[model samples]
Target: MSSSPRRPAVVRRAPGKLFVAGEYAVVDSGNPAILVAVDRYVTVTVSGSHTPGVVISSDLATHPVRRRWHEGRLTADGAQGGGRPRGGPVHVLSAVETVAGLLAERGLPVPELELSVVSTLHEDGRKFGLGSSGAVTVASVAAVAAYCGLELSRADVYRLALLATARIDPKGSGGDLAASTWGGWLLYSAPDRGFVLDLARERGIEAALRAPWPGFAVRPLPSPAGLSLQVGWTGNPASTASLVSDLHRRTWRGTASHRRFVATTTDVVHAVTGALESGDGPGLLHQIRRARLELARLDDEVGLGVFTDELRALCDAAEGAGGAAKPSGAGGGDCGIALLDAAAPQDISYVRQRWAAAGVLPLPVRVALEGIQQ
Candidate 1:
């Protein structure tokens, strides 16, 4: 028999991402959306030892476990007080333990690992529509795979992350996870079958490949310096799940207004994609303005102001400042993205400062080409 002990586990890293389109539309109908991995990322390091322990530490949570426990509910009286224990990180740990167990169940060797996480995105509760949680979950799953020496596909990892996060927040489309896992522009729909892949090839990699990557196109634009953006916060945060539920509920009532709004969104998204491919800045801005108008129509039809008054005012200000604004995620209130043409960095900075004085936060970002990997 071979005598060498298993080598110590190494650090694994996975990139995070943001979705460019189809945020809310991907909920019911199978309409494709695009996403790109951002430079912001989360890295997980796994260390193995003969001793039995599992530890995870990151900004969101930290848990150390000596051994596995039954996944059943713990009685309040059983915790030294001996009934059921107060809930804490146990659920998260339980999820992690389940992953480890799945590997063992599959007849794969398992390691007692210490996992450390380092993240460069959203340390606080401010999600900013940048897909932070999806990135972290994807990173964690990657760590587990590395610990188990497994080569599971990105799709499997994305599915697992979705299941795990759903258990906690009970919301979200898996588009962010797919973007962070697979990288590049993702064409995703609601159901499984409607999804399509769009990836950017590494310089040499694309050149050597016999054919172009499927469903992907290259768009030429001036560098990000000339493309200024002003991200506006609405102060009132929204939940994707709740917004989706509301949309569904409204649609089910045979609400003519809701139907019309969704139909309009479909057309706008189609137009957005066309403008994106054609590199028509003015056309893209127009579509964004149209999308905002449709959203306003829906808000009026629903008789509720989904975007806060302050947010609307800020968007109007951006439009006055030579850009068009639209909601970044499911409305209610979260953030808005503004697109500007051939703007100097100072102009964008001044715009952000103005928002900051009013208590809205702006984040700077550019398109990215790659997704999660080793």
Candidate 2:
């Protein structure tokens, strides 16, 4: 326990992201993706604590866990307040540890704190595949770092969050982090994860941030002109990590087919980005349909199950309503997005009704104007 005086809570929230285009292909460094941050958020609160160690509570976890932060590491002390913590809060713990690493490097005190997270991204502890993990990690990093007296820019926060996330899942593209960091509609590409991690391991977080990340980039794009975005949940959650890892495990990973998939996906992403930038709604819609077909072809070739029955229904309904739709992420099953002409409210309404009839849930969320913020 600390004898230090108590401090007010520092609260930060990060909005969940939905991939408008580019899914499996985005995993490759520099492969671009379009994403938007939604109003749904995961909020993290960090405050001074009298506890002997760190106490973490989150809506997604069954029980809180206590951890000891020593020398930039967070070691599980024990379960707190109930049955044993199952894996505890991995993303939050990683964020805390990553921040501690930076603080230690700067010769600051690593104080014990109470960290709590509540998310609108999940229901009954089930994620809607709205980038809950990413939002939580982003929010936790900002909140914890702010509580520890560290001031960070959005880029700084994103760098730390990516470093933290890479520590847990190296294969991640960090597209979600980018969306959660910047908010609104943006075009994003990931750096080489392995390279970033290696740089951090050999040098430090600060060193890694200062170093040139070869393939990573983020460019904000205008929201589709005169087009409205719609989202539908398949109710079945997916393991993005699993779907992605499955791609790596397959013999298809480095094969010619994989190369073709990457090339085609990259092309579609660029074209969609162009349409978005030009405010060509029809062109954007055309590109989205192409993107969906591209994923469908990849699925057919590799058997990745990119399109679930519910997701297919979701997209079909959108198409039936004369809109464009596609699965959002790695897409074993999660969410799909639809784009309809804003002037045609009836079309949007029809799509939503069809989605509900197909057992897909329509999420009433707008694009968030800010990313991780107080």
Candidate 3:
């Protein structure tokens, strides 16, 4: 008899994202922030392998990694003279390890597989700070889980990706991960990092992955009617980690100024979310301006210049066209977004030209309708 048909290869796609508001503040204490998953995506494909090892490859990597499952672990042939495999792309390795750990917890054998990743989130080999890492991690985990004949819900995939990311950097707010997992427009609050880390350490990866995450919440918001968005890239990548570290060192956590910043940002987020739900174009613009001003105040108080000259010029150009603009993420550089009022729509072409003249390249990105596509 013919052998049973081999399972087809599985491919998963997750989108990059940008913060609409609440950048630095979100990491503080689960503050709510708005984010949008963009059209650009990172795709991961996985298939069973006849060879006795797993192969992981990515366009971002210099070489593919070949690993074998032995003695309850994955190890490369020459990795540390037969010790556990270490040192591939951290994000990729973390994703694989997370999948392996979960499967092991369920008494499932690690399968031999081939995995590959491709992404359109970078420009000229420089990251656009579009949350590529989070997209890749989500896609990788989804693809691997499918290859193992397991299906994961959107929420479960998100928690698994977040857990894997936490293994690498526990300080992440998970805003990007949420955008990649759920897609579209979202209001997200990060879970308590300390709690998550402790649970993972004490109860293990499986328990943490299955547990109800505390202090984490994600709500989908409808795109406001009569509102248009435009993104401009500064062509310089900003290190989110560095910006967060600087802000942490400069601003005392939970102090009066910090509390004021959080409260103001929370109010701005509430206003924006309400405007979105109500489809109030003018109200959205008003809240966007207020939010940007709050960020400016936070920058001054912390003595960290999150808004650079290019970003300021981009925002100024947008405002000159009667639109509201501000830096999208932790903005030493990277991108800024402009929200144009529909009733008084500015010429987007003219806005783009002005942004170009100000040394910012306008990006063709929109809110992705779907989150993770499998």
- The sequence of per-residue lDDT tens digits that candidate 2 reaches over residues 102-165 is 8877878777799989999988877899999899999999998898889899999999999999
Per-structure clash totals for the candidates: 10, 0, 0
Sorting all predicted structures by TM-score, with the top scorer first, yields: 2, 3, 1
Ranking by lDDT: 2, 3, 1
- Which parts of model 1 have CA positions greater than 4 angstroms off? 1-7, 49-53, 62-105, 123-126, 166-171, 192-226, 233-237, 246-254, 303-305, 343-347
Candidate 1 to truth, TM: 0.74
Best by TM-score: 2
Specify the poorest-scoring 10-residue window by lDDT in model 3.
77-86
TM-score of each: 0.74, 0.96, 0.92
lDDT of 1 by residue, 1-374 (tens): 01225566666565655444455555543555545566667777776655444545565655543432233222222223434443544433434543554454456555555666677655364555566667777777767776677676665665556555555543355666777777655555443312211111122212212233233232222222334555666566666667766766664435676566657777776777777666677777887788788767767766545577656766776777777776766766666777776545665665677667766777665554566677
Predicted candidate 3 versus true structure: per-residue lDDT over 1-374, tens digit per residue: 01223578999999999999888778864789999999999999988777666678888778987776554445666244554646776776678778877787787766677888889998767888899989999999899888786678998889888888887777789899999999989999999878887887799877887787778999999987887889999988998888887777663666998888889888888899999999888888888888788888877777677788889988888788778889998888988999876565446778888889988999999889799997
> Candidate 2: TM-score?
0.96
lDDT for predicted candidate 3 compared with the true structure? 0.83
